[model samples]
Target: MRRWILLAALWLSAVTPACAAPPAPPQRILFVGNSLTYYGNLPATFAALAQANGHAVEAEMILEGGATLSERLADGSVQTALAGRRPQVLVLQERGGDLLCLGGRQRCEQSQHALQGLAEAARAVQARVLVLGTYQANAQASAALVEKEAAAARQAGAEYVEISQTLADLSRHQPDLPWYAEDGMHPGPALTLLDAIKLHHALYGMPEARTLEIDAPRYGANSGLQAVLRRADAAAPNAGTPPHIHYEHAQVERLVRALDHAARATDPAPATPSSAH
Candidate 1:
């Protein structure tokens, strides 16, 4: 009787849903941001995501921890560095902090100018430029700002990836989710990388990992974005939200339309100069 019971228990355990492990996410990305973008070894997340999905991807981070676009713009050397990489995708998360926290519409105007420069630089190098919309501790960014940022990207003919709201929603549910570090101004490197991947997947339509582990790990899922998630989860906590992670459908559709317009404007054109992260 005891032997029979043991066999039955083992069988039940094998069939339990709890026994199934969640599949790892994909990764492979290039990220740009302030210190909030670097601290947590976000690059590692991308590496892990790639490996989990049987991909071996790399990431290049061009972030000036704690410094916003204003600082980077003042320095004026990122453009040169960007030219050398000619990355597949160039992500730009402007606003060192949140717009609301800064206390001025002037900053928003400044951000617009900086974005234009970023777009030109990216276009020069023929890289896809992604505008990262930031999240806040007090609350997510205003939909107006999201629209403005997306519009700015559209005008410059660049891609748009809004991550702030997604991270904010994640924070709300996973209360302990640390969107920013102790400074409350920057995203940990790990989280930054994760955001990069998630946004890319959303924009480029990431697929599931269906490649056989034995294959050369061809492009199955989004290598660029999944790598970001892997790095964040390993280096930082990944608190994901639902559909609203970025915005309501209406806002997302707007962004999508902007991206399409940008694509059309730049289509059949040669790459432009490389810009900073």
Candidate 2:
């Protein structure tokens, strides 16, 4: 009877189905901010950069012109966006200065509150949060604010992408790099591309990786913009030298034109140069 029972147990074990492992979630990232994020759908560009570096990623963006984190938190847009899509990374950015934070005590407290709220939301969704350093038109004025924000972000347990320093360097090298639109306030594709590359490096720990090209189709509905981006991507620093990251003036102009046209299509107002940030 013992031998028979052992045989029956072995048979049952052999026939039973094994427990299945849950499917792995897609590597998703969500970018939340104002015009700085929206213009080029930079999150998508960043994802493309990552893909080029052999990482599969999905990126989304929440953009509103001249919006602040506090405003977004109050509007419920941030929460709604995060509910269904539990992203692996949540990127937060705002305009150059504390336009919405007001000033004095209010500015400091409100900024902290918003960051806290954002961090909490990210935590609930099991996502890491990243804060973009402030990029001002005057690079000189950026240092102090950037340092303050970087420390605050660290305190909030969020990584800070120091793109402002990168931008300042590039702008100094190529004074007319078309980093900003005619208004000078918003970023053009060239700048956005740099941001994408920088963000990719920061996220993947591959600062030296240098493939700056991405599928132009992902730039969205503007064919002119797509063509411009494709052209720019094709123009690496050196020909037959293995695609080094560099920018050309012509490529920058083409991208700026594409952005200008797109911006004009929505608002026929004449373009003006705003601050670089």
Candidate 3:
């Protein structure tokens, strides 16, 4: 009886499950930038893409038109967001002029300082930092500035998303897609969708695919855009393919359009002399 009991106890112990590793906490991301980020409804689009890609993400934005990183820090909005939200990721986007204008390198230094300050704050809160490489019409200047920003991110121990490079690559690969909006600064719908896709990939380590596309027939000409369309088609619940897989392409387009509206309405009003901090 004792031997049999010992055998049974051993079997029970072996069968008992080890404590499962805790599920990862839900992802929350905060985007801090000027008009470029807010205009395209980038954070919202990113959230939509993440949901479509099997990850739950919450995205919030602090957008001040033409605000530099130093200005944002001085304004204290980003600090408040970081403390209050304590997001998993903090994305920093400097204004385009600050990144590209090489007048005296003053803007560049300010940008670098801003990155460090943001990175340090994020580190304290145990959140990851992601810096967006600024993009503007002047591709040469844009590329140079992006490289510098990327270096700053690396120095600060943060990941840098090369938005400029992605745009350049897209322009080369699919020249037909409009790169910029009418203002010749902010990204258009196609570029905005691309940004969302790249952000999703950067955050989740997932490749861009057809099933993960935002709905815009205008952008459907390119292979990159087509991939997302395929994703949308594949996951359409109405198509009667898979009962569990469902994606609403219209929802994605709505988010994109809403972002565009927000961007348009908030066209950085001219700063008063006193208000130009």
Q: Using Cα atoms with residue i matched to residue i, what is each candidate's TM-score against the true structure?
A: 0.55, 0.65, 0.66
Ranking by lDDT: 2, 3, 1
lDDT of 1 by residue, 214-271 (tens): 1111111112222121222232222331111111234233333443444446464633
Model 1's lDDT to the true fold? Answer: 0.50
Off by over 4 Å in 2: 1-25, 99-104, 207-277
Give candidate 2's error at residue 146 in angstroms: 0.8
Candidate-wise lDDT, in order: 0.50, 0.62, 0.62
Model 2 over residues 1-277: C-alpha lDDT tens digits? Answer: 9999999999999999888997555477878776676555576667766665567677766655666788877877777767777777888886566622336667666777788798888888878888876676565667766776787688778888776665776677667666886566777767887677556645664322333454432232221221011122232222332222333444534443443454467558764432110
lDDT per residue as tens, model 3, 183-227: 666777666666776565466643233334433122111112110
Per-candidate clashes, comma-separated: 26, 3, 6
Among these predictions, the greatest TM-score belongs to 3
Task: Using TM-score as the measure, name the better of candidate 1 and candidate 2.
Answer: 2
Global lDDT for candidate 2?
A: 0.62
Candidate 3 wrong stretches, greater than 4 Å:
1-25, 101-103, 207-277
Instruction: Please give the distance, in angstroms, between residue 224's alpha carbon in candidate 1 and its true position after superposition.
Output: 26
Task: Write down the worst ten-residue block by lDDT for model 3.
Answer: 220-229
